[model samples]
Target: MNEIPLEHVHVAPDDGVEDDPAPAVFVLHGRGADEEDLLPVAAELPDDHHVISLRAPDRLQDGYTWYELDLSAGGLESSQPDADDFRRSLDLIVGSVEAAVDAHGLDADRIGLLGFSQGAITSLSLLLEDPDRYAWVVALHGYLAESHADLDPDGIGGKPVFVGAGAGDRVIPQSRTEAAIDHLEALDADVTSGSFPGGHGIGPQELDAVVEFVASRTA
Candidate 1:
């Protein structure tokens, strides 16, 4: 079957938080999740940063997925190796982000990326591809495919990056998560790694840590 074109859109915050010129945090949801699925996490954020959640565009059943999958024994996707496609999606996201920054008079240097599952893969790739585009990256419960290892991300442009995973995850193992951390560290990226006690999902502990990590960097 021919591949469908990808699309993405922004989800502003709930709770009526006024958009400000301070800074923005882009939120990416996991596979089978919509743009608003993870809004609660963004809304729970302690800081008053502008929260932007983007849809992955590819529909799978009722939810959405960023890329195709090969749901076998392990949680790995079939490697299409579509580097160009990935670049285009990243470009689109960055373009919209630029417009948002301009409209709100935000400091572009303070923009950050946050994602979960499939969204985590995209978020990490964005920082690796363009380190200066974000002030930091927060990846939660995601794995990096072998194809991503070939790209040199220039070490996060001296920005901080935090990776969190569940030690008892069913889909993602601890080793894969650790290897991702090693890869980022090898690139001279400032990285912090942590593990929670759950399985393939974000718990309160993970959220608390993520909130603290983001707040410290933005402060």
Candidate 2:
């Protein structure tokens, strides 16, 4: 993947709550979706938040992807980025968070991460890679990549996280979801996980839960 800069759009507080630095949430979209794809979802969050949706660096047909997809002789497609690429993306995202905080005078302690599918993969990586930097994580219809399972589970330190999946998501498979949730629990993370009666998409129920999660974390 060529190294193009990460692009994004942001939504500032609408509640008129003025602070030296407000809190923020980073929104990531699934594969084949652009940064703006999740703007509506971000908009549904609390008005006091600075919501930012990021575009993946790589272009794929009409959308973008965070990594190459490998489907050859595969049970399912998988991300093929090397460790360095993943780390570089992490650094880029973290840098963006820092820059957003500085530029908007946002509260660093309340920064949160949220994503659906592929975006959730990125969010999970960052949340697990350094839970201390983020206040909360909401991973929807996604799982933790095995590549990151080696991190010190103790690092989670009971951090608040929510992992929700669809009962009919064949693409992700129930096994992956179980493994991801199990891994988080084994590490003693403050995890709230469940499966909805749907497919690979989010519905109103999930949205309600998301709103609640964001409200609690940002409060």
Q: Which candidate should be chosen as best, given lDDT against the real structure?
A: 2
After superposition, candidate 1 runs with Cα above 4 Å error: 1-20, 70-85, 155-157
The prediction achieving the highest TM-score against the true structure is 2
**TM value for model 2:** 0.90
What tens-digit string does per-residue lDDT give for candidate 1 at 1-219? 222233344444345556555677888888789888887888766455777777776678889767765445443523332455556666666776776776556678788888987778778877877888888999998766565777775545456999998989876677777878888887778888899989988899999998888878876
What's model 1's TM-score?
0.83
Where model 2 places Cα greater than 4 Å from the true spot, the runs are 1-5, 71-73, 77-85, 153-155
- Estimate every model's Cα lDDT from 0 to 1: 0.74, 0.79
lDDT of 1 at 211: 85
60-161 in candidate 2: lDDT tens per residue?
899987765545536563533445656766777887777777776778898899888877877888987888899899998887876787787445978988
Q: Provide the global lDDT of candidate 1 against the true structure.
A: 0.74
Instruction: Score every model by TM-score.
Output: 0.83, 0.90
Clashing pairs in 1: 128-153
Span of ten consecutive residues with least summed lDDT in model 2: 73-82
